[model samples]
Target: MAKSPFRWIGRLTKPVLIACVIGFFSAFGLADRIAGFSANLGEKDRMVRWSAVLSGATRDAIPVTLIDIDPSTMAALGHPQSAPREVLAGLLSLAAAKHASGIFLDMDTSRPGSPAGDAALAAVLAAYPPDAPPLALARRLGAADQAGNTINALAEQASVLDAAVRGKPNVIWAASVSRIDEDRVVRRWQLSHTTCAPGPGATLPSPQLFAAAVASAHPRPLSDLNAFADSRTQTACAPGTAAASPPAWPRNPDQRAAIAFLIPDGPDLAAPQFITRDGRRVPLFRRMPARALMSASGAVVSPQAVADDLLRDRFVIIGASHAESLDGHLTPIGFLPGALIVANAVATAPAVLSGQPVGPLGATLIALALLGALVAITSRLRPLAAALAVAVAVLAALMALGRIFAPSTASDIVLAALGMVAFLSTIEGIHAIGKDWRARGWRALLKPEKPPAAQPTETIT
Candidate 1:
């Protein structure tokens, strides 16, 4: 007998119902909450860590260098709470002399230092040549008040240093902050921070971002960098000229980008190594001892040839790596120095600018497609086989998503996997209930068999 055309609709009813339910959850953000829970459990971090491991170290030459202030350097410099201003000035002078492309001093200069040291640092800043590479000094912001106003004590700088570079176009005060996740792992780098100030408001870019902005080969304007900041909020801080109060500092919702770690933390700093996926050795960033750059008298210690090769035309970041410095944070690979984190961020800057391989909408679509495909493929298998299929599909999706999108959309992949599992289980449950109902002849309550469709009785007496 010819089948009814409407039978196809009956066949599609269950799948359509499942799709609608999944779509509802996704649209209303329940899926996001599920993803958040997964992230809080470290699933997202694991995906990111594996992604970095599988992708391997960057092939291109690293354009950044770290001047590490390790224990030895700190002991040599008297282990002050802060790196001495004089020592920093000497390092700056050495880098400038070697034609470094840009320099970021990651040490906090929020308080006063010895008078002589301050004077020496100020002199170096004032004497910086017009043609010298741009300099970025780390500026720390005080805790925000109830109204979101922060106190940026200009006193954080040695009074002398502040005076020398107050209005210098080449000198920039950039924010040096990292976003530490709830698990205490530092996975993201906040690009810029805009806050209300007592005088004119201020905007500060992270050191990594500032380095990217002032890159010598292809310098980008400060305005260009704004595109990377949190687009949901106003990134521009208006001047407080009119006696009216400035707007409250907007919450930085999307200012941060996931850091793509190129090198894992090494146990041996003396002989650090990084091997890529293809078994090739690569350096993510060059590291040098701060002491190698200058002496107690602020005279260059390393030979000109060595210094030139190390510093010339490179973005240099000077930060402490000593254990006592308490500047280390947990990362995907392991506990690493904050300087290394900054270096990784600098390495990952290009990727951040390139953006996620797929955006939220695209990711959602991909996830839904993956779910639909999983459901279609697994429905025909035995229960155990179906479970295994689901597992394999979820694993494959996660790996691919992590490799292409990194941590930015890892949570979505996880959420999709979870939804698929729930969906399959619900389908199975419904089928089981239907089977039991028919076995017990309980289907009569819903819809009677209609006496076998009233089959004609052609039998004669």
Candidate 2:
């Protein structure tokens, strides 16, 4: 008797089912830990980093700059740990006069400074006109800075943060807390946060809000903080404008505004210069020493001269970038100061708002489709041919995904391809072995009976 040709199909049943399960889990992020377990295959975080890095520089220069509180600036200011409050006040005053789009000071003023200096800073901030470009002040978030009253309170504390804005109603207090990923890297960004405060409206916004506000002030509206924060897309301008309106984003109150790091880290972990659209080689965000913004006496440069050279409508972020300052955070572009991180975050607003961020759904569907196609193709070939063909095909698919899609999506495609291969191989292996087993069973079933012959022989004896 001949073996049933359908036996191979039965053998493939179990492996096919297992493969489907694996594919489903991988698609939904359930298999992330397992996939990440193998370094060569599991680099989800690195992929995320790569996606941002490959995003490349913007078509136009982002109108943002950073003022690093470097060693020289510290020496010039006659302060080691912190710049005097008066010096900062002078910076702010000059920036306001220069008509800067926004000024973000990334410092914790929770502790009181010299009484006279604090007063002078407050006076300068108060004297600014209501229509002055918005100023965002920062307060370091700690475990104590929760919803209820704690040590980080605004009232009980004689804080410079509060003193800096004593009579300045226009200044917005932005929480400087950053969300660190499980891998200890700052990838996601928070657009806004509600910090408990002492004022009538006792809530402080996130520094991202200030950045968005600055972006909104672009000659051509590039971003809308309120709409962007709420995850709603809004029309930014009329037809035929140079800027495109940002797409509507889904609202997430927890504020997981993921950072889009434009710069890529080199072998030295330093950001290398890239040629810009204008043919100039420059880093993503240019860093200027704080002293450059001031004079020999630590006074801010005259508004006319400063505007002519720098700070004319540019969004400026002032933060300590000195290595000992330890104000830097781990990012995809390597260890960078929070100020640069903030600038990168701001830089991505245009693209994110335009809804150009990578899409995983499309990639996932494509991978699954390719998996089906692979199964069909391999089923017709011999086992050896199937393995070689599938391997080559999966490699091709993985390359296409990595080059054409976001890194995360490409990784997903890779996992899907793995699942497809596992499924197909298991089926083929089982089919090959089952063919022999089925043949043996058929031979046993068809073998002629010897009982009759044995009975005749016994009778003759």
Candidate 3:
């Protein structure tokens, strides 16, 4: 016997419908929105934390060290509102002498300080060896303009510090700004902050991002970074154009990258400590007080031998950790100081740049395939059994994803798959309900009246 066309259509309907639904959702970014909601609910954070715990801790020494200006260091510096430039000069010189691979000064240098202090800092920067490790000084972001676009020249320290590092090959300005999500949690880092420059058709890299690039193992030249940032924008103003108005920047979504936090923060903002596979507990990043690098007279206190032992071949970050510094940020692990955040960025820069091993398209395709298989298997089971099977499948998929990809990427894919599951389940439920209703209606129509209830007529007779 020949098969009916309806039989073939019925056989292909569910799978084709499933594929269309998944394709529509992926194309429109509804899946991404669902994943983002999962992140907002802290599911991504939990996955990251759990993944870190499961991955055997690194026994290799951490490559970064933090020179924190804690409460004690603040008190020693006479409780100044900001770390004094003169004091910072001493720390810079000490790190240089120790031959640190990179030095990131996380303090504000926007406004001019005491003439002597400014001179001292400028002198240190000028005297820094051209062949020595790069020094990145943090420049604070100024208030955005009325139009909400960041003005490049408005960086806090640009006016004063720009001249300090102008002729110096080793010193550069970097932005210390971090992107805060709607929930106010710091989860992502930008490679460069694209801002409009005062000159015609000029674009500048935000200092913090520049600093991060400098701090990486393979640093890019400033010109390259600027060019890269410029390429993302659509238009550049003509030279000699008035700075009053500039071209609108392009809405490039790739400006920011996810930060992979390797070290978790400790309680009360204490130095983070973690246990390694060897069963030994140790600090994640070696931390020393800023005062330890300076003498009571504010001279370089750490001898070259000690400095080399601690800072040599390591990225050194100088920033405040005191409560008054107001530099703390809420991270996936816990509250961490801004300096620590930068350190994490530097340490994990390579991974962040590489991004997920699987792209969105690949992940979606894989997820849809798995979903199809899951539905085919579950369709043969009772409703209760089907639910159990789905739950198990989800758990297994999450575990596999965690092992195969970074926490953020894994969370996104898994959450997206769950959305598809929910959507399919709802559709199937409605179909079943409709089928039952139709069956009941057909039976009612076919059912015959039982001789008009003959008993009532018999009673009358």
> What local distance difference test score does each model get?
0.66, 0.61, 0.64
Backbone clash total for model 3 is: 6
Candidate 3 displacement at residue 278 in angstroms: 20
Q: Against the correct fold, how does model 3 do in TM-score?
A: 0.66
Estimate the overall C-alpha local distance difference test score of candidate 2: 0.61
Clashes of 2: 3
What order do you get sorting by lDDT, best first? Answer: 1, 3, 2
Quote the lDDT for 56 in model 3: 21
Give the candidates in order of TM-score, highest first. Answer: 1, 3, 2
Which ranges in model 3 have alpha carbons more than 4 Å from their true place? 1-42, 51-62, 146-157, 200-227, 233-254, 267-284, 305-307, 356-407, 426-461
lDDT per residue for candidate 3 within 276-348, as digits (tens), equals 3124453446778888777777565755436365777667888888888788999887788888788776654
Task: Report the lDDT of model 1 for residue 195.
Answer: 60
lDDT of 1 by residue, 331-402 (tens): 876898988898887765643443345556776788778878787878789979987887677667665655
Clashes of each: 2, 3, 6
The worst-scoring run of ten residues by lDDT in candidate 1 lies at: 245-254
| Of 1 and 3, the candidate ranking higher by lDDT | 1
